[model samples]
Target: MKGNFNHFKILIVDDEEEYREVFKEILDEKGYITKAASSGEEALNILKTHSFHLVLTDLIMKGIDGIELLEKIKEEYSETEVIIITGYGTVENAVAAMKKGAFTYFIKSHDLEELTIEIEKIRKIFYLENDNEIFKNQQKNSKYMLNTNNKKFIKIINMAEKAANSNVNILILGDSGVGKEVFAKYIHSCSERKDRHFLAVNCHAFSDNLLESELFGHEKGAFTGAIEQRKGRFEAAHGGTLFLDEIGDISLSTQVKLLRTIETKKVERIGSNKTMDVDFRLISATNKDIQKSISNGEFREDLFYRISTIIIEIPPLRDRKEDLPNLIEFFLEKSKLELKKQIHTIEKKVMERLLSYDYPGNVRELKNIIERLVVLSENGIIKDIDLSKYRVDSERDTKSREEKIHNNKEVEEIQRIRSLKDIRSEAEAKYIKKALEISGNNVTEAARKLSISRRQLFNKINEYKLR
Candidate 1:
């Protein structure tokens, strides 16, 4: 019942002056900015001059009827939502109005409660659709990526900021889950097109035919499932930004069409002869090695050059170990908020393990791990976590690297003609010491790292006097 409706303006249109005045008065009392138009023609005139979030128009009116006005509003001001007002016996007409793009219709009645509720829902939708609100939320959640201690990443951010001022295409190269989309949005937020839409498409998520139709749109009857004409992302994102994620995964044929669209600034809907001009900033991202892909003829070299006018490469999380503490804190607070838990402390061993583990999935994996820990936490403390569940591949990779190190040492020791028993004991002791160091001398973590039980690790410690 209590809400802020000052930002949303509503126009009440009805042939009857009393109905328009009464509805406007009630809406005004509810804190909504309201305007009244006696006829649908007057409503259209007012709309041409000012913006309104929702149009409340009577179905039966002189000159232009509600349906006619609704069609005009949709064709001209597609963003505005409409609600048709009808008499008791005109429910069928209201239903028809809905199919023609009315948000919802209501019967004219003394009680205004249902109308108010519908208005509140539309206001909430508008709030979510607001680009500024979305940008603020993104800034709150992705601030960790923007503010980092890594010098190379700081340079990348700086380059992105500078690139945002220009109308150049950008290609973000990084591993999966490295916040490529976040960086793309950051660039869009800083750019001149910040107030407009920031549309993102995952090129890897769709088939070649589907992706083509998705980007270029389709006319009615263009394909078997195409029932109505639809505008594509390129057209919808006019005067804004379009982020193509996993661009390297798009088929070569799609790449050719994409390249032409970029160069011509025009898009032709599928099965349509007419082309519409579109202007939007382009930001692309991919985890694949695009240069290798191009060499292998998997990606177009020319499209690569066009999209990579300003390339920004983000390093993997493992390479930026220094920023882990801040990243952990961010995700911890975010998870706590999402999970609605009051976690106040992280045990030293848990923190150590979290800090030492190499996240192959990057920031996204770290976020998921934190959420899992929060879910499993007890007594408002995060003490124990089975990171092995999330680190299966990372553990395997670590073991492979360790084996290479052990093998290199074994070859050197064999060259020196050392006894095999002595060599084995020395290598085991050295490996144990290394794991203990990596685990920050935590016995449980060291044991886990060595793939042994705590008692076994303690026995080894005592046998070698390694404590």
Candidate 2:
């Protein structure tokens, strides 16, 4: 099933039937899903219909030449690797193809063995950087930055600050990379404990025993290699804030001890019987559903209720993309200053392309992408054409794009606005229908998510006829 995710495609365009067939056969046997075309025209048509990770074309063609195909493919599909095959392999033709985004040029008479290694390098780029930007920038808003203009973000941040003004435990839940730590830091910085030490630890990074010792400290010769008295994160964070990241990944055995410490506000260090009273604001974060983990026996139900007295679910990047331009400006400035480059001003078209892509990795991914773009961006402008080498490979598949548009229309058309009063009802019905379908129709869960009273939700259910 994991192999299903790595399935890649390659397109071959060659006038020689024998060479085309042999290359396709070799690539197919080597696990690449391959396609073959006899001419550049056929190659273009196939490319529009399906996505390819790489395309290999012969320099000499019967009709519309390979150089033109390279230009079109580079313009249309920047992420797709292109290799040119030529019998002559002249300096003039080689330079032209390379300038037009030809990854490598090979002599047709030579062995095709070197081509595989070249393809592997392109594959690494896909794995490390693939869809990372698309996920972050799919919406027009930058997901990574706090939106000053967004009333929702401002409201949430203000509410979080108010919550931090107290001494209560808070739990933050959101998709990974949603800036849980960002908000945590905001709470800490704005709280009465701003001047104190604000320590944070990733609960998932260590095993049960190691995490316990890290949180609770150890005396001299406690367990293995405990030669001196050690101060735990709790002790160090005393009278301040202790931020636990990815708290959902903590083991069940570790959860019990954590619950005990959180409940008692006391810790007995290892190899010592001294019960240390710890005072700190606990701020835990998880990308997982604590209730689901509790149901699955992976987490304690009592701990779930105890830590989530004040829960904040961070929104995904797509929902608040209106802040992207500001974030892009900030990131570009940072990249320019750090990289010592005179990069300034990105083209509007490049911003449009960035907004059009989905960014699954959230703000962190966007920062990395902007850093790369700044270093690679030519001249003073980061134009769409300059980013031609970094578009999502699937975006080149015109057929799939059309299919997505059609599917969205089909879903939207179902929202029948029977009356002015029913417009809100209709849209709500549509989204509730979708989320329930995606979540397999657990009404209690859906009601909790819709943030509506179960009784009010049932009324809407009856109004919309959602069984």
**Model 1 lDDT per residue over 1-467, tens place:** 32456568999999898888889888888888888998888898999899999999999988999999999999999999999999888889889999999999988873789999999999988886675675789866666556888898889899999999999999999998889989998999889998788998988667799899889999999999888787899998899999999999999899999999999999999999998999999999999999899999999999999999999999999988889999998888877886699998887867777787888778877776787677668889886554444442345557886688677766575468768778667867876776677668999877754435686788778767797
Q: Score candidate 1 by TM-score against the native.
A: 0.62
How many clashes in each candidate?
A: 0, 12
lDDT tens digits, residues 1-467, model 2? 01222777889999989999999888777777788999999999998889988888988898878899998998998878898888764646966898778988877777778887777777767864654454224212332355566677778877897898898899998887667877787777678987676787878666688888999899988887776678899998898899999899998887888899999999888778889899989999999888888889988888888788898878776667776677778778867886788976777767776665555656655665676577667777676665665443234444676678677866566465467656667777986775465446877655644434465566677779988
The TM-score of candidate 2 is 0.54
Candidate that would win on TM-score:
1
- The local distance difference test score of each candidate is 0.85, 0.77
